[model samples]
Target chain A: MKLASATLMLSAARVEAERLGVIVCVSVVDAAGYPVAFLRMDGLALGCIDVCIKKARTAALFHMDSADFARVACPGGGAYSLELTNGGLTSFGGGLAVRDRNGVVVGGIGVSGASTEDDIAIGLVGLAALS
Target chain B: MKLASATLMLSAARVEAERLGVIVCVSVVDAAGYPVAFLRMDGLALGCIDVCIKKARTAALFHMDSADFARVACPGGGAYSLELTNGGLTSFGGGLAVRDRNGVVVGGIGVSGASTEDDIAIGLVGLAALS
Candidate 1:
């Protein structure tokens, strides 16, 4: 369960975004829901900050990726949103869970800019590379 | 940019876990940082819910995806966690942003019960399928 360092995570994300043709903001946190790294691309909306954090928390806490929970949530799926106690929680695009070589629940990734799928795509590619 | 639905996301995560032979939890959020779907595999810690939520938040907000950001930030990388006002944000693993057919951030995905990387992978695969 070894986690990648914040430095590598940010740099890789930047590189990946460049390849993907998207300017993205990324955030990383530890297993305890603490921040480890944060990077934002220029010319992005300030609102992205909030979106990124909640995405990270969902990955960290659930031990699951946020994207999975998001599809079946809300009233149609029984509204798990209210079930969660985390007020700062989010179910948006551009987040992913990070793991170490040891397969431990290490950190997370959050992205902004472009579309949600693009955010996820860039994020997955970066994580895959790091892994 | 189409995000996977909860049914497919969960089923795939479940199938992947079966192949991996591990128990896990998963979650998903929407573009607006809200819940879209959620699932808890048996034999998981209750606290994982919080971690997953925060992780998802990081991805959703930053738009860089979760894993990438988890690698950076904190006392070492300049506390981007506190920089954002979102309270439920996490920098952990197991979450990702989901998109629509048009590349809009329609929702998110999350997973648990295993390594964050595995979680990310499962989420990515599911999202990829939907895309």
Candidate 2:
């Protein structure tokens, strides 16, 4: 996604986060798992910053929601231990891939700070802004 | 620095990179060595993503340009082998500290995906934008 669009999405996510009473770190990455834009809200935990970026990268690189990837990476699953292989993949609820109108994967969004469900919800809100 | 200001710096760096006809990855980190923003231009090498972040983190954590850190970390120097101590420090050009008017370091910036000299020049341009 273009940087301007990515920044718009991030702004949308930030609004959602404020409504939810949470301070979080958000990241957007292109299809190749490279960052397009990132934001760490004031007062957020420093650790969440990197985690947010990695989550976005994991979604973009895998072309799937991190929650779904978590299921596949669970013990006894075909992709067990996959998270350990790529720098550090985040197979959690907060990461989501962004798709174009034609369903082509364009980028990804990752949100961190709140509960898993809230993170996922915020990420979805961010992706929705892209549409 | 705030994410907004960091994004401005990244934008300035992108303009410089475009003028040089080189694609690059840029990263900004807060005083605690946590990412505030990042961007990788389209078609740039994917490998530079993590490297750019690390470089920024290194600069922020050490409060010095990566090139100067290189001199200190070189073999026979007082801080030899220091690069391997952190997660992985990049002791080279392209990483620089960002200080506020009070002379306090607010953050750091790192640029990658070009020759060392070009990367350093681009990072400097980015820093200059903050002023």
Candidate 3:
């Protein structure tokens, strides 16, 4: 995805975050799991910055929302301990893969610095901006 | 620095990288060494993603260019073996601290995936954009 487009998506996500009254760190990564864009709002938790980017990387690499991947990475699941691989993955909510109109995966977005549900909401807002 | 400004810097750096015929991974970190932005050009070496971020983090935390810090981290230098600390620093080239007009450090930028000199040049392009 083009960097300009990624910036627009980040802007939209930030608006949603403001509406939700939560500051956040957001990350965008291309389909190959390479970072395309990232933003950390002022006053955000420093640790969540890495988590946000890792979540986006995880979503892009796996081509699935991080929340869904959490199930697959759970105990007795096929990909247990997968988070330990590939630098580190976030298997919980808040990461979503971005796909083009033809449904081809283009990138992924991850949000952090809030409750998991709110983070997921913010991530969806970013995904919406792509479509 | 704001994410929009960081994106502008990344865009400018990408233009310079294209002119140089090199693809690179770029990262921006806040004053506290927290990641604020990151990008990897298409076809860039995957290994450089983490390296670029680490370089930016090192620059932000140390308040100096990675190339300059290399001398300090050299054997018998004041900060020898410093690279082994703080999640691993990049003492070579391609990382630079970002300061405001008042000369207050606000962030840092790092570039990787090319020769050390080229990386440093690209990093300067990004820094110039921030000014």
Candidate 4:
């Protein structure tokens, strides 16, 4: 993804998190799962930082929301143990593939430091900023 | 480091790399060694991405240029085998500690995808942008 797009996603996520009265870390990665932009709000727990990046990579690498990927990677699921690969992956909420104007997946955004539902909500807000 | 400062550094590095006629990956990290911003320019080799991050981390962790750290980490040197202690580290040129106006170390910038000398030069340009 272009740096302009990644910065917009990160800014949108930060605004949504602030509006929700919670601190969070957000990460954006290109289609190849390399970091493009990242922000760790002043009050976010340090441990959640890497989780945010992994979630974005999980979405970018798999071309789906991390939560959706989780369903397929769960025990007895078709892609069980898939997280073990790709350095590491976070198969959970808060990650969403970002698509371009043509609906082509170009990157991903991830949010952490809130409940799964909130993280997902914040990430969706970021994704919306792109379109 | 604040996101604004990190963004400035990344932008400066990009401009320098463009002027030098090279594609590069640049990374900025906070004092604690967490990534702040990163950009892998179009055409940058994928292999250099992580190296860029590691270089930033090495500078942030040691509060010195990675090239300077390399001198100490070399075989039979004081910091021999130190790179293995951190998740990993790049003890070579291309990474430099970033300081605030007060001369207080705040973060670091790292560049990759060019000769070590060019990488260091680009990173230095990034550091200059902050001042």
DockQ of each: 0.08, 0.03, 0.02, 0.02
Which CAPRI category fits model 2? incorrect
lDDT of 2 by residue, B38-86 (tens): 9999999999998888888878866678888788554434333345434
- Writing each residue's lDDT as its tens digit, candidate 3 over B26-55 gives 998888888888889999989999889888
For model 3, fnat equals 0.00
For each candidate, the alpha-carbon lDDT, in order, equals 0.65, 0.83, 0.81, 0.83
| DockQ, candidate no. 1 | 0.08
Error of 2 at B30 (Å): 14
lDDT of 2 by residue, A15-56 (tens): 999999998989999998899999988766454666678778
Name the 10 consecutive residues with the lowest summed lDDT in model 2 chain B.
Answer: B73-82
RMSD of each: 17.0, 14.5, 14.6, 14.2
Q: Which 10 residues in a row give candidate 2 chain A its minimum summed lDDT?
A: A42-51
Q: Encode model 3's per-residue lDDT on A80-130: one tens digit a residue.
A: 767556766776778898888898888889887777789999998888876
lDDT of 2 at A118: 90
Off by over 4 Å in 2: B1-131
What is the full ranking by DockQ, best candidate first? 1, 2, 3, 4
Model 2, residue A14: what's the lDDT? 96
